[model samples]
Target chain A: MDEQETRKAVHDRIDQLDVPQDLVAAAIETGIDQASGKQVKPRRRRHLGRWILTAAAAVLLGVGGLAAVNPSVSRALSNVAWLTNFYLHHDDHFNSFHVNGIAKSMDQKVTSNGVTVHLVEAYYNGRTIGYTGEVTGLTKAIDPEQDWVPLDLDDTPAKNLTSSTSNFEPTKSGFRFHATFLVDKGEVPESVLLPIRISNVNGVVGRWNFNINLTQSQQKHAIQQKPYDLDLPGGEIIPVSMTTFASGAEFTFRTTTDGRYGFIGISAIKTAEEDQLIDGTDGYYASLGITHLPLKEPLVQGKTYHVVYQYQMKTDGSPEADIVGADIERDIVLWPAEQ
Target chain B: MELTLKEITWAQQAVAGDREALGQLLKSRGDYLYRTAYLYVGNQADALDVIQEATTQAVKTVAQLRDPNQFFTWFTRILIRQAQVLYRRRQKETTMAVPPEQVAPMIDATAHLDLLAALQVLGADYRQALQLFYYQDMSISEISQLLDVPEGTVKTRLRRGRSALHDQLGGNYYG
Candidate 1:
């Protein structure tokens, strides 16, 4: 066989390998939804007014008085740890989760092939779940930056799963890893069996399945405001809603019908006094939470806040725009402080 | 699969943030991407993972792409990077946990195709260059652009890779 024949053989062999149609369809679907800012599944409608009222009443009864004296209750509600171990060592941030005495501690370990993973503690506050653990008996050092430890929810309805690992260090035996997993509101069950798999451990993939039982505590302090319809440059109107929790305020911008331009995220947030530039650290954007702004001041109900956002063409193929000058401002009214 | 003019238009629309166009673009390139991934990872499941990850990365970073006409090249580069990452990771695992003989066999080439077996024996760089050259039918310049190397480097690799294949399977193997 000559080069031509060798080439033909190679092509024929590659063509013979079966590519699963289901996988292709799923991949295409996920790509479209992510690129379009569409939700994986349509969110079930909840009675926003009723739920907010109930959450507010619970907050008032639980920590309304403590909030006045220390302001820690309100602060804690605003300082949400979006990424695992993000604020773990930051005493001010990590202490807030413990202050409410809502966080649960567990000792679960899974050992396989000379590797052992110990899950120490976890905290779930309706929206995000954070857990910390240590691994031992691994010959190779685990670098979170290079390694992908994906949290797989078995027999659960979790969606939009985002995770972050921090404070990865080598121990005498192995390494200690802290990770946070974020799920959409009302996704995880009371008890979930989460299989955290380190897809690449120096190339040896391993999984540790932990049965986590969560105790639901009403968010100690939460304020919900009416959704605001904001106009864009292209004559498109997007509905923006703000919900304040103990960890932070979650701002959601609805996707527009025209796919040409979509809400990327807030560039700057203007409170009466100052303009805060949204560095990526401040928040993340998806269709859900356009930004989860950690509040400097407890959001007073009925008080209006101004938000400045930068929009971009949805796909990379779109022509470049002056995003710096393309700031769209909208005044958002907070729901009444008291029902 | 060869990209049609309509698909190129979709690629442009996709880069412009049109989700439907992006979907069409992904669908058109799905088989090609899968085959490329399979060449690197040598398995169905891992190849699928590579494609999924590459798609996600492409979607997230599509805005950074400058030329819409270069969408396939841009996306293919992303796919190759993903495959490389997975390949490196799997290599580490196999080296550490599994014995050489115990490692799972590569997908069986048809009987009498000793060249396929010989291809596996070649270094990753050589195999990759040869795979793109013969299997994907890519030009040296295209391979160089995708690999982010000079055209001369791609040519050298192609020459050396073919020579290695010939040496392994005997000179008449190619004929």
Candidate 2:
């Protein structure tokens, strides 16, 4: 075939590919459900403590001395826990620990530029730290397009800092703002004094300096680490270490120097469920930290686990290696019966 | 496809947390997304799965989008990424037990089988470049933006992809 005929042939083939209308409709329906938050399953029962915290705060504020004397209210207030439920529900890394009850309270507040910013709650697991709070005092809605960096606690921005903001339900004083920030796995400090400066908030800037005590959560658990050698399809052996935590397992390996051989991902199974694939985290290239392979349920001390590591080989000029396929390199059994 | 003003408005509303607007925007681009996904996975069922996943991801992360007018480019990027991921996962699952020749016979009959087979021999980057060029008729600049690569890289891929395709199909050069 000539140039014109080749173009026609390729175009004809691509055009002939068909998409079913029913599939399109179903996909749109599913997208709408997910977008509207209908598909998000209700979080674990641990979140009930958060609801109790909210209720306790309201009663303490409303009834004053009378509510303080109530046994249940007093007990809840003493717990004064920071709920990691929001992060636990959304992030795989944060979900590894079975955290219940709040940490120590750092309910600090400041007023400047006619706006009040409150640091409502803070939680520090062994790995991740997060804080949630609110900002009030605005005549009109702030620009939705602008992403205001509210605070910079550390000398540098945390490697995986994530922040989210939502408008509070409208009240007579106007709509307040609720915001939260989660700093991913980083070096933990005893205490951090976060200096907050929010600019362009209804034409006025808000500033606050609050000290947060990174009190370790009672729910933190120690991870058991074991080292092993994983053999790839091409007979190349790579050293890898595995760590098992309450929430999931982490595999750490070194990346290849030639950029040809690399760890792709892993699949794992407990006795109760079928094999489930876990995608490698965005942090995979950071010395090959295979973070967050969540178990079907939280890890039990004696339950056996089976896992297989997958790796890819991409040697130049090797057609066999050029095939885009990840092969299972090694199978591992965790918590052997003798152990 | 160039987005109309109404589609752009829908995208803006979708980014502003309007579920109905998201549905409308996704429905408008569903066919194109599915077709593009099909080019990557080479099967109708897997392509549909990729489209659904891409739609869900786009809706969840819509707030991060900066420009409403660039919705197609942003969504296409998400769709292609999802397709690549699913394709990789599928390859891993069947690579040992089943080879490409056995799977080719099961592909949907609507597509030209010979061309599809030839396309499979090209590297993923080359196949994607050729598909976007000839199938979607996207400009090299547009493809570069969609792929998040430099324009020069896109041009090189197109040149190399055409040459590879010509070689695979016995010097059937096009343009």
TM-score for chain B of all predictions: 0.80, 0.82
lDDT of 1 by residue, A1-339 (tens): 776887777778667655555556566676556555766542221110100011211111111111112324433332334323433444333444444544555566766456666666666654556666676777765444433332222212234444422334455566555544455333334433233433333334543444454544333333443334556544243434444443344444444435556344444455687644222221233432333433323355576767665555555435464322256777765334555
Best by TM-score: 1
Per-prediction RMSD in angstroms?
16.6, 25.8
Stretches of candidate 1 off by over 4 Å are: A32-339, B63-67, B95-118, B167-175
Residue A180 lDDT, candidate 2, scale 0-100? 33
lDDT tens per residue, model 1, B1-175: 3567998789778788776777778877678788888778755556666877787788788878888887887887888899899878766655345321111222222344355457656777988898888877788888887898999999888889878987986775444
Q: Docking quality tier of candidate 1?
A: incorrect
Candidate 2 falls in which docking quality class? incorrect
Worst 10 residues of 2 chain B by lDDT: B99-108
Q: For each candidate, what's the DockQ? A: 0.15, 0.14
Give TM-scores of chain A for all candidates: 0.50, 0.49
Best by DockQ: 1
